[model samples]
Each structure stands twice: as C-alpha cells, then as structure tokens.
Target: MKRILVPTDFSAHAENALKVAAQVAKKNNSEIILLHMLELPHQMNDAITSGASIPETMLFMKKANETLDEISNRNYLDGIEITEIVKMDKPIHGITQVSKEYEIDLIVMGSHGASGIEELLIGSNTEKVVRNSEIPVLVIKKENPDFSASEIVFASDLSEEAYLPFEKLLKFAKLFDSKLHLVTICTPNSFKPTHEIEKITKSFISKFDFSNLETHIYNDTNIENGIINFSNSINADVISMCTHGRTGFAHFFNGSISEGLVNHAIKPVLTFKV
Candidate 1:
C-alpha cells in the first residue's frame, strides 16, 4: 500500500496539509502516517543541564501528546490506518530520519513562507524537507481549500533522473483527473538535440496512461524565467519539479530553481526529489 507521511507541529498549516493528504490517500486507498516532532524550548534544555525540575519536562511532553490527539480527533481521519509518531528533537532531523526509516512515498507539510533572518537560516521546515527528501514533497499553504489543480506543469531537464518520479506524478494526475503538461526549457548555450526530440518524448509518454498529456519546448535565456513564463501562460494550477538540494555557498550563490518558483509563482509548487 502507498505510505504517505505528514509531519505536524500542531499548527493550522500542518492541519491543512493533513486535510489535503487525507483526500489524496482516500482516493488512492493508501495509508497515512501522522508525525509530530517536539523540539523543547531552548531555555528548557539549559534549565535541565542546570538541574531544573524534571516534572516540568514531563508536563511539556504530556501537552505535546494532547495536542497531537486533539488535532487527530478534530480531523476525524477515517478509513485509513493512521499511525502517529511523536519525537522530541530537532524537527527537520526527526522528519528526515522517519521518512527514510518508513520508506515514505510522499511527504505533506505546511509552510507560511519565509521572513527576515529566518529566510537565510533555513527558510522553513517544509523547504528543508523538500530539498533533503528523496521522495515527493507537497507543501500546502494554509488559507482556503478552494484551490483545485486543473493543469499540472512539470519542469524537467529530461535527464535520467527526470523520469524517476513521473510514476508518482502520474498517480497524482490520475487522482486529480487533471491534464499533465510536460515542459522542458532549453538554454541558448545548451547543445541542440542531435537526435529527434520527439523520439525521446514519445518514449517517455509510452510509460504512462496519459490520455490527457501535452508536450512543449521553450527556448529561453534563464531556467527560472522560462518556467515562470510557461506556467503563467498556461495558467497552471500547480508547478512540479525535482531539486538536488544544494546548500551553503551553492544555495547562496545559485539559488534553487524550485525555491525561486515557490517564491515567485502565483500558483502552488510541488517538488519531488530524485
């Protein structure tokens, strides 16, 4: 059965993501894993080292469990085997470790975007997991539930890794019954295709049951601009891509295309790691 992992922090945004995950899981007959990570307050750890009251820590843990149960019960997630995991540690580390251990197929998390100094530090936990995960990650913005993905735009380099996650995307498209648009942006300095591009495109199409698929190629100066323009032109509901999760100097100098898309795109962006 398909396993979907959703990490919650008892936030409304996380709850929104769980709602969407429930819809997807219900449609696919998949199982859902609800995860909660409890990172103690910074001062609490210092207090513990200084021989503070251990009962306080116990109270905090109890509260965390109560919060998880409250959210789970509120959602009334039924017809699926819902598993809950609560961990006390760093949120990102806890999530990444659990994802690998469970072999999660998809991860649904919530984000409120980035702000000020936190933008440079790590942006958000959803962003970090999207970059670090080897599975598909869907970050939902908590607001309204009126969003419907009518057209799915995929930004790819047509590399060997590009096709790896298409199976999951196909499953997503089928669930939504949305049209799948495959797009590739070619740079001015990039090598032109030696063989027929249609041959490669046809080979990829043969792998999926895509009765609603369209292909397009654009000659653009920059990858980010090309994707944004195509998405705007098509009025895409969601933009999907694969990211390599380069950090440090690389992330600073050469910002991630997926990150750029998320920051700029008017539509929701879903990222899958290969």
Candidate 2:
C-alpha cells in the first residue's frame, strides 16, 4: 500500500493539504499519515516558568488530534488506516526524520509563499524539506484549491539529479491520469541543440506508457520568466522542479528559481529533492 505523509501546522493551508492528501489516498487506495511538528519558540518554556501561561502548544497538539479524528471518520477513507504523529522539533527536521523512519512514499505540505524578511531569515521550510528529503514533496499553493492538476509541467536543466525523480513523477502522473509536459529552457549564451538532450528526453519518455506526454524546448533570456510564461500559456495545473536550496552570496543576488516559481506561480508547485 502507498503511504502518504502529510505534515500539518493546523493552518488553513495545512488543513487544505490534508484534504488534498485524503482525496489522493482515497483515489489511490493508500493510507494517510497526519504529521504535525511542533517547534516551540525558544522562549516557550521560559514563558511557562515565568507564568506567561503558554497553553498554545498543548492546544496545537489537541487540535491536530481532533483534525486527524475528523479525517479518519470521513466516509472516503473507510478502510484506509490513518495515523497521527506529533513531534516537538523544527518542522523540516521532523518531516525529514519521519519520512525516513516511516519510509514515506510521498509528502504533501502547504506553502504560504513566504517573502522579504521572513523568507530571508528562516528561509522556507518547504524548500528546506524539499532539498533534504529523498521522497517526493508536493507543495500546494493555498490560493488555488479549485485548480485540479490536469497537466504537470516539469522544469529541468537535464542534470542527473533531474532524472532521479522521474519515477515518482511518472507514478503520480499515472495515478492522476494527468498529462506530463517536460520543458527545458535554453539561454542565448547556453543555446546548443545537442543529441544528448534528445536522447535523454526520448529515453525518459520511453519508460512511461503515458499517452499524453509532450516535450518542449524554449529559447529565452530569463529562465524563471520562461517557465512561468510557458506554464501560463499551457494552463498547467501544476509545476514540478528540483531545488538545491542554495543560500548566501550565491543566493542573495541570483535568488532561488524554485522559490521564485513557487512564489509567483498561480498553480501548485511540487518540488522533489535532487
């Protein structure tokens, strides 16, 4: 049976992710694992000792349990087993640890599109989990629930790591009966039509029996703009890419393509660790 791991923070976005995971599990006949990682601030314990009355931690756990109970009682997941895991640690660390321990096949989480100071300081937990975990991470943009992913757009540089997640992506495409669109952007300076690219694309497609697979190559100056524009042109339901989680000087000026796509894309952006 397929095991789906969903990490929740009890936010509306996380709850939406849980709902999506349930739909996916019901469709695939898989079990759902509802995980919540509680990373209490450093002052949490101190506040308690200082009589600040920080019961919010307990409240979070209680709400998580209640939500899990609600999901379990749903008629859609009648036979599918539902498990709840509550951990006190950083969200990304907890997610990665649970994914390894449980051998999770897929991870579903929500992204709030963090930006500016918040993003610069802590970075994105979703991005961190995507970079650290070996499993497939599906990030749902909370604004676009009505958008069912009928077409999946994959942005790749044709790197070795890019191909590693194809197995999982193909499985997901088959499960959803969605069309797969593989795209690679070539800049003016990087413009070179090589046989290797063709071979790689063909070999990848040959492995899948999908009837609705399309490959495209775009010549553009900005990679991010190319991806976003192509996705918009095709009206893709979802976009998938591999993130390296680069930071510091390299990241400050160049910025992260995956984070930029997630922040700008109107559709769901599913990221897999390379």
Candidate 3:
C-alpha cells in the first residue's frame, strides 16, 4: 500500500473514510491523497452572459480547498504524508482520473448506502467508482470502522470469473493477516444441494491452495441479504467480493451483486473488478 486515494465531500461518512485510510497509511508507511471534487453548476446562456455562474463556481472551489486543507491539518495526520487535490469534475471522474495519475494502490471512499430502485438509479459516487476503477476499492459506510481486519467474509458463487478477483482479494486479506470465511449464498432461485455446494467450495479452496480459511453455504432470499446476514453472524471485520463492473442502463438489467452489497452491507467492503 504505497499510495491511497480518498475522495471526500467532507461529510461525516467521508471523514470516517479518511480516518480509516489514515490507519492504513500509518501501518504501511503509505501516502494519502485527499481529493475533493467540485461539480460545475449547470445553467443557461443567460446565466453565463450575466457572469452569475463564475463567482458561484469559484466560491464552491474555494470552500472545497479550504475544507481539504482543514482535513489535512488534523492532529491525527501528524506522521502521514498528505497531498490535497481539488478537481473540477464529477466525483467519480475526478477520483478515477487521479487514481490513474498518481498510481494509487487503493481507493478508500464513503457511501451513503442507497438501496433498491434508488440504489440502481441514483447510485452513490463511491458506488460508481467501485464499478469502474481498475484498482481495488474499500467502501466505508460508518464512522470509525475497525481498520485492523481480523476476519474477512468473502461471498461469491465460486465461478471461474470470480477466481481472478478472489486472487486479488487474498493479497488484500493477507495485509491484515485475517482469516477468510468463504460463503456461497443459496437463494431460492439458485439453491444447490449441500453436497454440490460443498464440493465446489472445496475445489475452489484446493485450487487456490489457501490456508487460514473456512467455507460454508448460507441460505437467504437473495444474495445481498445473504451476505449481510452471514457477515453479521460471523462478526466479520470486512466483506470482500468481486464486481462485474456493469454500467449505464445496462446495470439495471445485469444487476451487479457487488454494487448491491455496497448499497446494503454495513461493514466495510473491499471490491476487485472481475
């Protein structure tokens, strides 16, 4: 973890993400890039002719920079190297662009936890980045989440596509020296015999040659609910999963399980693109 990118709206949840990122930075001797995005206001030609949008946009930019400075000067950042960036673009675009520009190792972001139709339509900016970024993303939902992950719950179908992301997930899990709890969510629509589930789980585990892990099948009405219930049951430190990176209106049809988890799960979720 040489460099971490944290995008902030300066909300309490964003502050929570910053704190968690600080912990990781402290542990790995990493640098923190504190980024803030200033969305350009939309208006008609009349507003542009009157120069009304200019001052408003400038004020917004000024305020954003001030907030970034305030966050970077906090006492907790004493030993951490912090670089503040203020971008004039949408949150997701700014974040992904900066991540590439700086060669960021990971992106830690805050989510407002959108759900159902609202979740699909008005997906949070954090959710958008999780869907598009090539690097790994850590979605933080609460204030002061435990940074030291002792146990991680990874829910998946153990499909061939999942194997790639699972491999990246293992590298992240090893950073905290955490035990992995692998789970297959058995929903009514996709239920499998226990023996079949067990066989696949065992094969996946053996193929990976992973240690310090356990596997099981969890029953629920859906994958989202199944993951939430099982992680809560195990008191998992974090939830690791793979995103198909579905975008646009197409996401409405393909429906990413990773996005669903990000919207509903209260625990920190680490996502890798499949």
Candidate 4:
C-alpha cells in the first residue's frame, strides 16, 4: 500500500480517521491524499465547473483549503507527505475520482454509523464508499486510540472465487503481522451438519497456501448477524468482508446486509468488491 486516500469533512469522526491514517502512514511510509469535497448549492453546482468566479464555490473551496492546510500541518502529520485536495463535487464521486487518478492503494475513512449522520454526514458516507469502491477500504468507526491489527476476522463463504479477495486480505494482514481468523457463517436456513461444514471449509483452504491462520465455522440466525456476533466474540481488531457491489455480500440474496455491517459494526471494517 502506497497512497492512502482519506476523505474528510473536518468532522470529529473524520479527524479520528486521520489520526489512524497518520499511524498507518508512519508505519508504511505512504503518502496521504487528504481530500475535501463540496456539494455546492443547487444554483452554483453547474457554475463551479465554469471557473472560480462563483462566490459560493470559491468561498467553500477557500475554507476547505484552509482547513486542509491546518490539518496537514498538525504535529501528528509531521514528516508525512500529504497532498491536500479541494474540489467541488459530491463526497463519493470525489473520493472515487481521486482514488483512481492518484492510483490510491488504500482508502481510510471514519464513521459514527448511520445514526450519527446528522452531526457527521461525511462519516456516514462510509456505507456508500464500501458499496461502490473497487479499491480496498478500511473504515474506522470510533476513536481507536491504540489501533493495531493484531487479530483480523475475515468472514466469507470460502468459495473458489473468494480466493482473489482473500489474497488481498493476506497482504493487508501481513502489514501489521495480523493473525487471520477465517470464518464461515453457518445459518439456520442454510444449516449443515458439523462434519459437512468442516469438509467444505477444509476443502476450500486445502488448495491455498496460507500461514498464520485459523479456520472456524460459526452458527447464527443469519449471515450479517453471524459475522458480527462471531467477530465480537473474538474481540477482533478488524472485520473483513467481500461484497458484490449493490447485491450485498456474495452469500446474501438481500441487497443491503454488506452496508448494514459497514454501517453498524462497532469495530473497524475492511471491505472490497469481488
């Protein structure tokens, strides 16, 4: 991982994420792209593209740049190369565009869940980013004063197609020397006998060369609930998952469970599309 794109609205939650990003950058010597986006007033939205003549857009951009300057110069960000970006665009679009344009290797953002959106709108947009971004996303839900990825829980169906994302997960886990806990959620509706579940789990992993790993089969009422409960039980530092874009988790038929977890998981969530 090289450039980490952190989209900020200058909220407390966003600052929480920046603190975490500083930690990550120090460890990896990566560049931080701190982006601030403005969804201008309806009348000024089109005018923003014309030039810097519009007063509203200009004012917001100046304020955003000043705020970015303040954030970039903080003691916590000292010695770290930061590229502050200010643009007139929606948060999600700006993030995606910058991620691609800069060839961002990872995206880190903070959230206070969907419930806290009134005071932290940018924080809550983590759901939209997790639902859409192709690049790996690491979400910070709250202030993790002493963040470390010692234990990571990766919930998946262990399908053959899952190997690709798992490979990506492995690279991330190795960053912090995190031990991977690979879990397969066994739900009541899709219940299987213990031996059958083990047989499948073992078969899927047998073909791969994985080290510093443990396998598990957790039972619960549903996939999302199962994942959350299992992760909490282990006190995992991070919850990793794969989603099929808008269709939600590849294992789920419903179209919202992936974001549901992203919006609700108390621990940080690391997600990417399959």
Candidate 5:
C-alpha cells in the first residue's frame, strides 16, 4: 500500500473518496495520486490526439490542473504527498491505464449510489473500474465516510475460487487492524440447512487457520439484503466481498450481486476479483 489512486469528478462523492484516500495514505505513509480525466468532445477526440494543439484540450487540461492544485492545498491534505494527474481519455480507461502505469497498490473511488436504470448510466464508471481492475478497489458511497474500519464484515461463498480474494481481504483487514467477521449469505434462491452451511464454513476456515475471526450464516431474501442486514447488525465499519470479474453477456445476463451491494451499501466496500 505504497500508493493510492483516486479518480475525481470533483463532486461531493469524489471529495469524500479523496478524504478517505488521505487518511489511508497518512496511515501507510503512502502517496495519493489524484486523477482527473478530460472527456473530450466527440469531434475533438480523435483530432486532438495527434498534437493538434486544440484550444479546448488546452483549456480542459489547465482547468483540471488548477482544480487539482486547489484540492491538494486543502488543510486536510497536509503532511501527505498529493500528485495531480490530468489525462485525455474516458474515465474508466484513464483510471485503469493510470492504475497499471503507476503500479498503484489500491484504488479508492466514490460512487453516487445510483440504482436501477440510473445506475446503469451514472454509477457504471465506478462499477466498470471494479470489474476491470486487477488490484483491489475500495468504494465509498457517502459524502463523509469513516475511513478507519475497526470492524470488517467479509461476505463470501466460501468456494475454492474464493480463497485468493479472501487472502487479499486478510491483507486489507490487517491494514486497519480490524477484526474480521466472515459470513455466508444464504438466500432463498440457494437455501441450505444450518448444519450443512456450518460444515462448509468450518471446512473453509480450517484451510486458512484464521484466528480472532467469527463466522456466521445469514439468511435473507437475497445476497445484497443479507449482507447489508448482517453488516448493520454487527455495526461493521467495512463490507467486503469477491467479484468474479464477469463481463460480456455473462455479466449482462447474470448481473453481479457484489456490484449491487456496491451500489447500495452505505459502508465502504472492499472488492477484489476471485
């Protein structure tokens, strides 16, 4: 966790994310890279790519840099090394490209918590970044979030494929020095007897030999609701889950339940691809 990448549209939500990034950076002695993507007009997109010296591009870059400078100067940002990045690309593409190019350890981003059809339009950028990013992504949905997560609820299916993400989750939990509450959401669509669920949960726990952890099987109408309810019941500070990184028609048809939680969960969500 040497570096954190934070993409901003300068909205209240993005400011919340930057605040969270600052907290994490201070704790880890990390650098915060604030990125602003300049989504050029359709006609200027291709033309400006070839050193066209377009005034619009120049103006956009100048304004973005100025905004970043202003944000970096905030009193809250003191003591942390904040770098501003302005790129000419789509938000998702720019974020992914910069994350890889800079070798960022974690990507902290904010979503407006859009849902239903609105989410498909507005919230898709953050969701797309989550699906595409190989590194772990932490999503903040509120305007002012508690960056320090003392209690983290990690919800998983406990499958063999889940171990990798769970490993990543452990590293994250260590960062916060938080107790982990491992849980499985038993929904109506995939109901399981309590004895059977416990057997499987115990088997998975044995593989990791994880100590100072508690496990539970939560029942509800669906995975999203179950995770939310369980997390709230325990007064969790962070909600974590694994995503399969499904894309194309598979993602379209099945839709990602983890993503659904991302859209609605008020607590910070830590997600990684399985």
Candidate 6:
C-alpha cells in the first residue's frame, strides 16, 4: 500500500473511514490523499450573470480547504504524510481522476448508512466509484480505532473471473499476514455437493502458495447473507469479495453480490474489480 485515496463529505462516517485509513497508513508507511470535492451547480454558470457564481465558488472553496487542513492536522493522523485535494468536478469523476493522478494503491471510503437502503449502487457516488475503480476499495462502516486485517472472510463462486481478483486478495492477505477464510456459498438456486466443491477448491488453490488458508462450504439462501453469516460465525475482521463492475442492464438484472454486501454488511468490505 503506497498511497490511499479517501473521498470525504466531512460526515461522521467519512471520519470513521479516515481513522481506519490512518491505521492502514501507519502499518504500511503509506501516504494519505484526502480528497474533498465542491461541485458548483452547472446551471449557475449559464443562468447567473457573468462572475455572479465567483463569490459562492470561492467561499465554498476556501471553507473546504480550511476543513481539509483541519482534518490533516488532526492528532490521529500525526506523523503521516498527508495531501489534501479539493476538486471542482463531480464526486465520482473527481475521485477517479485523483486516484490516477496520485497513483493510489487503495481507496478507503466510509459507508453512507448502508442499513436498509436497497437503492441500487448506480445512484450513489461511492457505489459508482466502487463499480468502476480498477483498484481495491475498502468500505469502512464504523469506527475501528484499531483496524487490522487479522482475518478476512473471502467468499467466491470459484468462477474463472474470480482467479484474477483472488490473486490480488492473496497479495493483500499476505501483506497483512492475515488468515484467509475462503468459502464457497451454496444456495438453493445454485447448489453443489461438498465433494465437488472440495475438489474444485483444491484445484483452484493449487496455483497459489498461500499457507495461511482455510476452505469451507457454507449454505444459505443467498450469496450476500451466506458470506455475512459465515463472517459473523467466525467474527472475522474483514469481508472480501470480487465485483465485476457491472453497470447498466447487466447490473440491473444480475445485481452485484459484492455491492449488496457493501450495502448491508456492517463489517468492513474489501472489494476488487474483476
């Protein structure tokens, strides 16, 4: 982890994720890029008289900078390399642009009250980034003053697309020296026998050299709940999965299990794009 990009709305939850990112930075000696965006209404530029929007824009920009400075100066982030960026573009675009500009290794974001909010990922800025970013995104839900990837519950369908992200997951797990709780969720709609699952799992992991690994077959009605239930059963620190970054009609029909998990699961979710 060389640099972490954290997009903030200055909400309590954003701070929650920021604190966790601090712990991560401390662990890896990584730099923290705190990004705040001020998107002036597009209509203002066209409808308002010339220079009419300048005052409000500058005022908001100044206030955002002050706030960013305050956060960077917080004692919790002490001794950490911090960079503050305030962009004028939309939230998702700003995040994408900044991540590339800074060569960020990871993005840590605070979940915006995922409880009972079934509204699809397409509508939310955070979810939009989750759906598009090529790098790993860590969604933090609550305060974890001492966050650690001591154990990660990684659920997979063991499909071919999973291999790529699993490799990224392995690199991360090894970096943190975390135990891997690899699970295959078997639902009624897509059930498979334990012997077959074991056989596939054996073959799937044959290409890797991770020693701190555990494999299991879990049963539940859905993938999201099964992963959550299994994670709860072991009290794992993180829930890991792969997202296909589905969008438009495909996302509408198939819906992303990883995105759904981010919405409902209280535990931190680590997602990588397949």
TM-scores of all candidate predictions against the true structure: 0.78, 0.78, 0.87, 0.90, 0.90, 0.92
lDDT of each: 0.70, 0.70, 0.78, 0.80, 0.79, 0.82
Candidates 1 and 4: which is better by TM-score?
Answer: 4
Q: Which portions of model 5 show Cα errors greater than 4 Å?
A: 46-53, 114-123, 247-255, 258-260
Which candidate number maximizes lDDT?
6
Which candidate wins on TM-score? 6
Question: How much is the lDDT of residue 31 in candidate 5?
Answer: 94
Return the lDDT, model 1, position 57. Answer: 82
- Stretches of model 2 off by over 4 angstroms after superposition: 46-80, 114-123, 143-147, 194-211, 245-258
Model 4: worst 10 consecutive residues (lDDT sum): 115-124
Q: Please give, for residues 1-274, the per-residue lDDT of candidate 2 as tens digits.
A: 3899988766767766767777778778888888877666678867766867567767766876787677668674577778888787787788888888888988887766544212321246765676666787777766443546579998776555556566667777887889989987767655658566777777767765667888988767767677889998898888887655454111211335534655676567676655
Q: How many collisions per candidate?
A: 0, 0, 0, 0, 0, 0
Candidate 3 local lDDT, 37-110, one digit each (tens): 76654663356568867776677778888988889999878899999998877777778899999999999887
Runs of candidate 6 with Cα error greater than 4 angstroms are 47-50, 116-123, 248-255, 258-260
Q: Model 6 lDDT vs. the true structure?
A: 0.82
In candidate 4 the C-alpha lDDT for residue 262 amounts to: 52
After superposition, the stretches of candidate 1 with alpha carbons farther than 4 Å from their true spots are 46-51, 75-81, 113-123, 142-150, 186-211, 219-221, 245-255
Candidate 4 Cα deviation (angstroms), residue 82 = 0.7
Q: In model 6, what is the error at residue 257, expressed in angstroms?
A: 2.2
**Better candidate by lDDT, 1 or 3:** 3
